[model samples]
Target: MTILLSQEIDRTSYEPAYAQLVNILQASMATGVFKPGAQLPSEAQLCEHYKVSPMTVRRVINILLDRGLVTTAQGRGTFVKGVDIGEAVFHLSGLKEQIESTDRAQVQLLEARIVEAPERVARKLELSPVDWTIFVRRLLLQDGTPVSYHRAYLIYDPRRPIVEGELEVTSLEGLIHGNGQTDLQSGCLSIEAVTLKEEEAAILSMGQGDPAFLIDHTFYDFQDRPVSWGWFIWRADRLKLSATIGNRPPQDQQSAMKDSRRWTGEDHE
Candidate 1:
């Protein structure tokens, strides 16, 4: 508790007492004064040391809980939470941008041709099985090591520029953000753990039946119509998703909402 007492709540500042206390505790944690899993001072101790009421200390604890900075047990006191890397947010653009940001990243076009829409893909894209669709496959690599295999089925539209640029990795951004053909209104993504099949294994240069991640994506137009559908198979060790949590300004909240809408296809009027 000596470390916690080194920083006192500012009494004269315009900031609320609770806010100042929170900053003190947060700063202590940042400096490793309060290591992960360390128990915080008891409510009585905090109240006595800070000269604050029990309600204020409780409120501070609640705020810490909301920020995911601490956890509480029924019988035990609050403790600092250990950072868990697996607790991360998944974002489509984030993943794409991360791969491209790598200096040695490369994208190789494997196949691009018209093919009859598969029943599942047709249903997902709201197309008939008899309709023709553009089938595109690409391999993503980093430093010459295969990382992901991309397979997509797009609605056949010769007039759209997306079809022409679909063969290039740069155009993948157009597919997500939209090309002149149709602006991307929204989209949804699903990911699951899967074992690599023979073909998938060969493409990723991994052993057959190796663990991998399968991400399915579906994009829609402003009309709420499905425009494109595809999946990306990634090596298990190649990707890790992360996101910011806790308080944000109104503008930042709005921006996060827009990103959510783009990825989840949630229509917000």
Candidate 2:
């Protein structure tokens, strides 16, 4: 079980050895020492070398597994995952255009229909308990490979005509903007790591329990009226987001300040 690794675990530090092992392996991967498809040291090897337990080894492997950093074969061993572009931080805007600009990227409408608003959707839009809304589901692709699955529920006004064709060809974000009445003012967007469920995995062409990003967006209008929002699930290995960390433009800053004032007054948006 004993094997030599030049960079041994720091037993003195408070951080668990398993976590440290993850960092070491990540550094190794970044430095090309652990190339894609290369098998990592076995559990016993890690245990003996790090003076740790089998449980600790398992934790390390599981962390790597969930992050899509490594994969395993039934009786074989764990191998590093190969990824083209992975991991990103993004602002609320420009998400759709970013995906399309990638090579041969396209959007495919999976389902679009008018349906009664679920409680959660109603609460987000601040609608009555029993209300109607448009449900839109779509898939994003790169070179025909599924990258993300997006589902959205919007405030549906039955009086307005539904344009199916335009909805299919345009990004949901763009479509919402085109309405003109629904001005997306400001809200929250959060991204979290998630284990894909059976249905989500099937749609993303990945295995159940595979790693993915769950992005939740909640936005209001200029008048602070909650209108529509989207929840997007993205494959960890295929997608990355980027953000600019700077002050908003002057006009946007003014708008944001106004939004903040409006938030304290009424729970409209």
Candidate 3:
């Protein structure tokens, strides 16, 4: 099939041709320019259109394969994956918790193993730069449509075999809590706006540079030690987010005022 590419890779920049091509293709797929089951342009066509080598095209194709964006058949060319949606998901709990509560949500584990985390993630999980961490990657789907991508990092317990003990653990927090080592009691989570990268765009079937939510969450054990640090990226249009805050009791408010007055050296009597 003859596919039209809207953007060209800047060869002068340090970014490689394949990476740029991946980004371009991801944007097109996310925007529904190419629907699922639609055949991607042949390698030779991509090479000609992008003015890059066939090897570059293949490399980019491999990335899309790894990301579960497109599948290649033995005799046929690669085609986009299907993304079907139903009623959108709303949020009151964490992603895993939300998935657990929802009846129709299904989890597809992409990768799960022990791996070394990056600098910021390492710091967040209170692990040394070189320490190995348990990494869990999965996709949450609702009605056969991928809704979010979740990556969680946990401090690997050496004595306990986490994989064996928590083989059926559904949630990241549950994975830690069920280990019989420490209970994850609470989480501190912050949500911010983020632009979907090429890889994320491909995984979630959204356009590249699309608006999404970057949820950074840290789970704390009963002792208040950070047990895990997780990141979740949800497609902007795939979910609606809401929160509920209750009013503080009058006694709690009075106590807060008294504490403030005591700190400020005001008359407490």
> Could you say which candidate leads in lDDT?
1
Model 1: residues with Cα > 4 Å off, grouped in runs: 1-22, 25-98, 158-170, 173-182, 241-269
Clashes of each: 1, 2, 2
Q: Pick the candidate with the highest TM-score.
A: 1
True-structure lDDT of candidate 1: 0.75
lDDT of 3 by residue, 147-250 (tens): 88988877776763443333334364354234455345667878899999999989998899998988787877666767678888987765445332221112
Listed in order, each prediction's TM-score against the native is 0.56, 0.48, 0.48
Local accuracy by lDDT, each model: 0.75, 0.70, 0.72
Candidate 2 residue runs with Cα over 4 Å from true position: 1-98, 159-182, 241-269
Residue range 62-105, candidate 2, lDDT tens digits: 98787667888878888887763433335444355546364567
Candidate 1 residues 115-196, lDDT tens each?
9999998898888899878888989888899988998888876655554443342245454434445456677889999999
lDDT computed for candidate 2: 0.70
Q: Which ten residues in a row have the lowest lDDT in candidate 2?
A: 242-251
As a TM-score, model 3 comes out at: 0.48
